[model samples]
Target chain A: MSLSALVLHKNDNVATAVRPLESGDSIDVEVADCAVKIVLLQSIPFGHKFALQDIGWGERIIKYGETIGQATASIKKGEHVHIHNVEGLRGRGDRP
Target chain B: MNFMGYRRRNGSVGTRNHVLVFPTVICASSVADMISRAVPGTVSVTHPHGCGHLGEEKEHIIKTMVGFCSHPNVAGVLLVGLGCELITPELIAGEIAKTGQRFEILSIQAEGGTNATVEKGKTLAAGLLEEAAAAGREPVDISELIIGTNCGGSDTLSGLTANPAVGVAADILVTEGGTVLLTETPEMIGAEDALGRRAADEGIEKRIREITSATEVLAKRVGVDMRGSEPSPGNIEGGLTTLEEKSLGAVLKGGTSTVRQVVGYAEKPTEKGLIIMDGPAHDAVSNTGMIAAGAQVIVFTTGRGTPLGAPIAPVIKVSSNSGIYRRMKENIDINAGDILEGKDSIKTIGERIFREIIEVASGKATRAEVLGHNEFAIHSLGLSV
Candidate 1:
């Protein structure tokens, strides 16, 4: 199956969209050597990331096998992950 | 592996034999430029520095200037100064003299005026070029090479494609007993802990944390948000959402080699392997620091294409995506974007880059070098007083 998204690491809960994905579009993803099908909940632009599983609010968001930020709102599988829903955990003077 | 390179008098190998006409102050930049143009095989190094600098800032400018003069790539140097600048031509010449490299100094005030200074500089530069041209390339081992790695105009595909591919190339170089210098201290903020794990010792790991924290503090003190500047508008448009995301991908350019040491800006590494230099996130400044630190060649990964190059080193531009590669074919050298299109694997692209490095070291002209994009800048620690 052609991979529409890339899972950078085995532990990452999000995968980057290699191609632009639209609402109601079903795509095949290679997650941990397994082929999984996901239906897009919203339009995910190329290079943007999408949730591989349901992420609760305030939960850590992992990419590149590291914590990039945390979820600001509950995100469902196939939802686009970006600034609107995710908050960066570093470089903010307010954060440790 | 062996490549043909110029063996310098101090027993260092140089990929280019360039006679450098270095201006000590911004005021003398024009004189240096005119002199370099008058003399064949000479290059001029100019920047907006060398005056109104306080303690550490003054010291850093002087050190970086001297580093450039004594860089292995430079065969000889002609220092041009305004005579009244805080960083005198004598001081810069004194430092370069220690490296046993041939050098000459000219002061605009002492030489009467611009035309006279340029005339004197041209004569001096011509002599240096004659000497520089005498040096010849000989077969040198790959271990003698010091390669610098950097990512600029980066995007999502950067971490996914070009960066990791560069990592593989870095690993191969390390395996072959060569050195790779990874810079941009500010970009390593959130990924410090992960990078620290690769340090060769606890002391080195502690230094990594200290430098990253200090960089953050510096940004906060300036009343600027690092986040806004780091994920620049271009970065955001290219799909990077956070500084952490950019950092996580940026660190992959260092490969898995143990962090041997952390050096100051423009400071050369005492040991080999993957050494990190403390420098700003700006591409030109970071690239200049590494070149001054003795990197004979630089591999720059870019998702958004840029035509940045160094005056002394051959900068091999690697495009992260095929789109940018196709759009800017003249500027880009390697296309790691094939990995994203599933046309090529990371290992294959990595090996190709590794081979390209050897070829460039052996005198292959990179696109930037051929296009004359000699972008150079020095990082300053504090405001010039």
Candidate 2:
């Protein structure tokens, strides 16, 4: 059985959970026709994103094959990607 | 294809024939409310502007008010003013007169007080409603339609299903020679390359950049990031992390039509096809700008389910999931969730929404209208002085 998740594009490094996914749940997702199986490292709420591979801090996070934001902290594979761990590079009024 | 609509005297097509009661200032809102309540069938709109505004703010308030007052969807307007406000009913009434539509003005100070003015307004509003009631729908070509596309309470599936579905409908409309307006400048943050590439010309491409980049500048000037706000707390809960991600999904409602024109807030478009109106991402005000810009109907997509309706036009909500669709049945009109459930294709859902638009334009009331969701608001560009 496969957990529900969707990867929008081949270049996207994150997959969004179509349903609530728990830690350790294995979801087989096609990252743009390239099938990859990822084990959840953290519980991902419905509509949330998870890393397909380990993402280094400050590395651009790709979704829809474009930069959505950059990782503020290092993200392990299957770790939840959210506001707490990522910062949008655009429209940043806080940065000098 | 043709749909039944009210053809105005100025050669404009109206999806609904409404007798509108408009307040020029917040102070006159109560008077407008009283007048509409007294006149049963009349619709009323009020805003937080009309007095003490300066420069572009004042002009924007007047233009928005005038746009609504002179909208083709409105059969007639009863403009109520507080007499001392900068945005006088006479100014708005004069603008409407140029459109050759029916309108009447009521000044509280000139009529002696709220009681006397409201009594006069009731008479005027009742007359307009009577005239509107007698007006019947005639066949208007589908090409005359200008649709507004927006998304609120969005989520990850929004991009996957409802937004793209709305986009499909937008594409269908554009193909049929109808006009489509896409706005929410704040949401267009990171999707510039995708949107700008679709521009009809070099000037249009520059405008797409100007509007999106301006949103960031405006936010920085206010000393706050667009993160928490543009994604919104609801958006974050629904899994949208950044303004770019949300915008990438948000813009899908515009479909893939060429960008024919880029308009200022509430300004009517001169070109057909997919046009962009510069405005913020807030749903109510964003909807307001499009309605003022001459969209007769709005196809709004939502994953979290927003119950917003325009005072003058119908808002057709497309839900992203069956769960939220079931919970907000009264607020939502169509279910694009079938695509996500593997029951319906995106193209199928889009055709269904396009069909719904024609039906709604033919005088079928939307859920928002049937449920009395007459939500209205004005965009604020600067601090009120």
Candidate 3:
């Protein structure tokens, strides 16, 4: 699927919506090899990120090559990512 | 490059010869407001904090009240008090006296009551208006100008464009011996080390560390992380992720000028160059702190755009993205988006902004001023009663 929504990076594992998209709508997203069909698992609003790869709890989520937050639960490929799946890492000292 | 302005005895040039009426205590705010309203070109600044504070907070309130009256923008002052408030009208009167300007005081108890106080205040205000109007404009050097820098609703383009452009303008102003006040202490959280490296002296570096660390520790005590609360929903949408990332862009509004001094909230900058004010990241209170600090003009960068303005000082709006600039042309005065579009360099835009600053200083109305968005608020240091 050729996805025109978000491209996290050339080597990253998530995409953000440039605009809002509904769940189950397939968008053509450019990834590795050819255009990949990304089916929205949940409605993604504009500017919100989505998982490009599987993420685990307590692991850092990198956006713009910086740590934005940590994954709270396991997130699969193309899953809608937001506050529910990511938790604020307070008093965690510093990011590595 | 010069517009007519009111020249003060202190060698400061004022854009407006406003008669300021300040209520030291909340109880006297109504009287001050009534007095200000009764006289044209008079302003009333009222806040709810002068009564229930102690030590440093009490001192902060008094200093702020003093600073506002001596702001250089005001031609004269009228201090109203409830007589029994912690900040006495006498003390407030003393502060105004130090400025060597015309001022009068009225206490509710001394004047018999609120009605009497208001009448007394109205008479005083009317007299002040005529006196201030007599103060004529004289030619003053650019060095006499104290400008404040702020960025709000930041986006990816903020750091890359608007902020750097502002930095250039600030650099020009600073090099020319003008003063620039850079504030929003919380926004400096993640960039302390970088800021420290730019500090002019060890004492300034230490002050920067102390203020940033103090805010961080306070946030931790409140069970909230400063980093998490930053990059608000709007900021995230604009491509900012971490607090550190947002701060890097935010601090660019300060330019590469040496950290001349660090001031507490509402404290005026005594020295010229780039001074940091310890204030909340909120625009309303922070802008008020800068205005109170004697900023005659303010250069505000907005990635998402804001219409906030000060009652006395003129606020110039700069936008990072050309898209937003095109969409909100009325709210934005200058567009730094040319940097993003590769149409111009930072220096080019900086010159344009510098010209606008002079133009506004010469009496050009900013978008906010044109829209009458003179919302003002002073940052509170202690608990409200």
Candidate 4:
């Protein structure tokens, strides 16, 4: 299967969409020496990230092998991970 | 590796030999511009500051002006002044004289009027240009190269593609004993710890924290949140969700190198390797500061795209995605988007970028230079009044 997205690091929990993905599309991705297949749960815009595995609410969204943010809500495999369900941990006056 | 560069008297190598018409005060900017226009091959450095600044703010402008004039790329300088501003042409000339470069000062008041000053400035600039033209590029080592890295109009691809790819190229440059500058302090908020870990020593790590925190404190004191402005509208639209995410990607351009030192805005680094400049994230302002600090070339990565270039330095623009590269083909120098398409590997593209840097350093005109995009801005720390 052709690679549809890029997994930047082995520890990254999310992958960026190289091309837009629509609901019901089955995608194959090559991550560090391994291949994974997942069915899109919703349409994911190009350049946006999607969950490679189920992420519970408030869990960190890992990319570049680092935590970029935390999921505001539970994110399932292939679900779009963006501002809608993620919260930045930096510079927020509310966060300690 | 060696590239043809103008060897300065002070032992510094310049990628381009240009006679700069530098204005010491905002009041004399028009005459400076006029002189630069009348003399071909001469460039003018004009800004709104140079008067009415207080304390550190005033000193920063002075230092940046001096640095720009003394830059190796400037073969000579024609200093223009209003004669009454805090930063006098004489003072600027004194600073540049330290570098043993040719410089001549013309104050509007001293010359009796704008018309007279313009005439004198034109003749001086032409003479300076003739002297500058006499200089020729000699073989210089890669270690003399100081490369500035910056990103603007960024998107998700910025971190994944262009930024990291530039990072790889930066690593190669550092390995070759060259210097690389990573700026945009506010952009390092979320990734401060990660960057701190890469510092060469505790002092640099502390300075890095100090500068990044200062930016945050200033914004907070002004009753604004840094996050509110970061991960800007363009970033959000391009799939970046938070400031941390944006920052994590933003720092990739520096590569995995030790932070040798953290310098104040427009401050030159004393040590080689990777240095971080303390300045705002504004594209043009940061680029200007780096150029003033003595970066002969800049590698600007963008996802949304910008056409910013420095007057004294060549800014090589790299587009993160193929779409923006195709749309802004005339402006962007290289496309790292192929990495995203699985057509090119990051290391290969990184080598290509490094080679492009060598080419630009050897007098290859970048898109911005060819388009005459002389975007210059100085970061102000205090109110003009």
Candidate 5:
């Protein structure tokens, strides 16, 4: 399906869903010169983010050509990426 | 471009001619409030500090008080004190005298009691208000205006729509030789690299990194992850995922401009163009700092919706998306949400915001002003004792 989503930068690993997206919906997204299709693994609310490609555990999640956070768990392409799965690497007072 | 403004004897311009009821300390806030309420044409500004501060914090408080008293927006001031407070009216007066501001001081202790002080304050405030009413706005160059930009209650659309739209307006003002300010130091975290590239010189670039690092140090020292406080509950609901993401989006309100100077909290910029005021991200505290730093008007962008406004300056609210704009139409002045639906582009919405700024600067009361949102707060050091 043609997706209503935005990938802010070419180097970004995630795309923001412009509208509510449901599981099983396949989205075709183009970031820079590359075009790819990924099926959603979980329901995503409007304005939320989804991984454009598989992100390894503890790997940096890029958006706007910058690291927004690091993944807390392995994230599949098209899976929801939010607080539960992504943790900020900066200002991490919980860690020593 | 020019807007009609109140020309002050001190060689500054005022968008509003207000008689200010100023409280020197927390103990005098109620009396100050009472005085402003009793007098017509006066604005009340009260804060929770006036004692138990030392060194730089005390200096910041004094600077803020002097800044507000000498502010171009205020025509006259009635300074209220509790006599024993650490920040005495005499000290404030000594500073205001240099700025040539007309003021009167009423100490509740010296006046015998609250009732007596309030009575005397009413008389003093009334006189100032009467004098203020005679002043009229004259045509002034737009470059004389110092516009402060702040973003709060942001969402995903903030980066895409309202923030950048406001950025365009900021650039317009800057290109016209006017001043624009980018504040909320903590919000610059993830966008430091992008922002540093636009710094005017090596000193500014160094300051940018220092401020960003300082916020991280503060977050770590406090033991509460900034992400927890940032990307707040409303932000999560609106699709903001993390502090880095939030910072990246929030800093876009500055637009792409050459950073001219970096001033301390509540310190006015010496250089014009796009200056950075180092302060926290709290809406009220940040707004107060900007206003105290000589910002005559504030262009506040929000996606989650806030009715926050300064006690003095006009806060022009711009919504990042249509939902919040419709939900809080009474509070919001302009809607950039049309960009989401392709009804408007960022440049067009920015131009619209720029026009609204001119109208507000030329004496149009914002929705917040009409609704009476006179909020004020001081950024203080955490410890009270």
Candidate 6:
């Protein structure tokens, strides 16, 4: 059986929580078409995002291979990425 | 894909043939309302804006009045104004003239009094009613349809079901060559990068940033934390924990189409593929902006349910949660509950919505329309008139 979550792109540093995911639970992630195993570091609610890689403080968080926001706090791989850490960066224009 | 629609003199198809009595200033609203009430199939929007404003604010009210009259659904327009107001009836008529639409004006001062203006307006509106009645539905292409999408009373299911379903419908309409507009600037705050990636070109992307930043700076100056103000209490109770999370769901209403153009509040879109309008997140105000942008029809997606509708446009309400569907059956038109229930995919429900749009455009009344829900509001820049 496949995991209920989906990671939209290889370059995306985040994966979408299609289903409620619990901390320490393992799921298969197809990064760049190569299947890799990653365990959740925290409970991720449905429709929320989880980090695909280590996110440094103040670094932009990439999802769908685009910067949706920046990490207000450092996030380790497989941890939930949301308001507890990431915050929207205002004033900076979008990259075309 | 064809529907029978009333064809206007300017070659635009109207799903509804309405004789509208629009007030150019707050001073003439009561008189305008009297005229609308005296006539059937007429609506008068009572707004507090239109006086004591300068520059763009004044211009926005004038343009919005004209756009409402030129809307494809309106067969004829009767403008009511105080002769000395910044937005006079003549100026309103002048803007309407650009659309080649049928319009007439009545000025209270010029008419000698409110009673006189009302008497003249009623007479003029009566004649316009007959002219509107003469126009009948003709075969119209789907591409000619300009649709607006809005989401309100959002919950976690909104992004997961209703919003994404709207996205699907938006994508389908664009593929069919129809125009779709996405608005509510504040709701797009945490998700600008995602929208920029969908822009038609570099310029369109830049425009999105400029408009979004402008809204943020304006909100900051007013001492409101825009992001904190997002995800209303209802939204938080329904499972959304952050503004960014809410925005991710909010942006899904546009589907995955390329952004064709960006417009200011009440500015009509010149390009026809997909556009974003600068609008507030409030239901009535945002709906007004969309209607002013020439949207002949609106698809309002809700997870917690809303009873909002535009006076001139037919608003088709789509409910994301089954509980809301059952509870607010009188207000909702379609149920996107299948996505939440895991019975059907988002694409399937989206196609269902697309079909519903065609049906509504073809003269089938929406639940909101049947309930006679015509709530109108305008976004103000906090300028006390």
Q: Give interface RMSD, per candidate.
A: 3.9, 3.9, 7.7, 3.8, 4.1, 7.6
Residue-level lDDT of model 4, residues B1-385, one tens digit each, is 8888999999998999999998898899999999999998999867897788888888898889888889999999999999889889998888889889789999999899999999999999999988998899989999999999999987777888898889989999999999999999988988887789899999989988899889889989988677677676666777777777778889989988999999988999999999999999999999989988889999999988888889899999999888999999999999999887678877788889999999999999999999988888999888667
lDDT of 4 by residue, A20-96 (tens): 88988998887886879989998888778899999999999998777888989999999999888888877432333
lDDT per residue for candidate 6 within B268-319, as digits (tens), equals: 7889888999878888888888888888889999978988888889999999
lDDT of 5 by residue, B293-368 (tens): 9999999999899999988899999998899999999999999988767576677999999999988998999999
Clashing pairs in 6: none
What TM-score does prediction 3 earn? Answer: 0.77
**Candidate No. with top lDDT:** 4
For candidate 2, give the lDDT of residue B359: 98
**In model 4 chain B, which range of ten residues has the least summed lDDT?**
B227-236
Q: Give the top-scoring candidate (TM-score).
A: 4
What class would a CAPRI assessor give candidate 2's docking?
acceptable
Collision count for each candidate, in order:
0, 0, 11, 0, 0, 0
lDDT (0 to 1) per candidate: 0.87, 0.87, 0.76, 0.88, 0.86, 0.80
DockQ of each: 0.37, 0.32, 0.08, 0.44, 0.29, 0.13
Ranked by DockQ from best down, the candidates are 4, 1, 2, 5, 6, 3
How would the candidate models be sorted by TM-score, starting from the highest?
4, 1, 2, 5, 6, 3
TM-score of 2: 0.87
Per-residue lDDT of B232 in model 5: 71
Q: lDDT tens string, model 5, A5-29?
A: 7676789999888778899998766
Name the candidate, 2 or 5, with the larger DockQ value.
2
Residue A76 alpha-carbon offset, candidate 3, angstroms: 24
For residues B137-229, write the lDDT of model 2, one tens digit per residue.
999889999999889887668887898789989999999999999998877877887788889999999999998778877887889556545
Best by DockQ: 4
State the lDDT of candidate 1 residue by residue for B170-265, as single tens digits: 999999989999999987987887789889999999999999989878888988667656666566655667788878899888787899999999
Candidate 4 overall lDDT versus native: 0.88
Please list all clashing residue pairs in model 4, or write none if there are none.
none
B-chain TM-score, candidate 5: 0.96
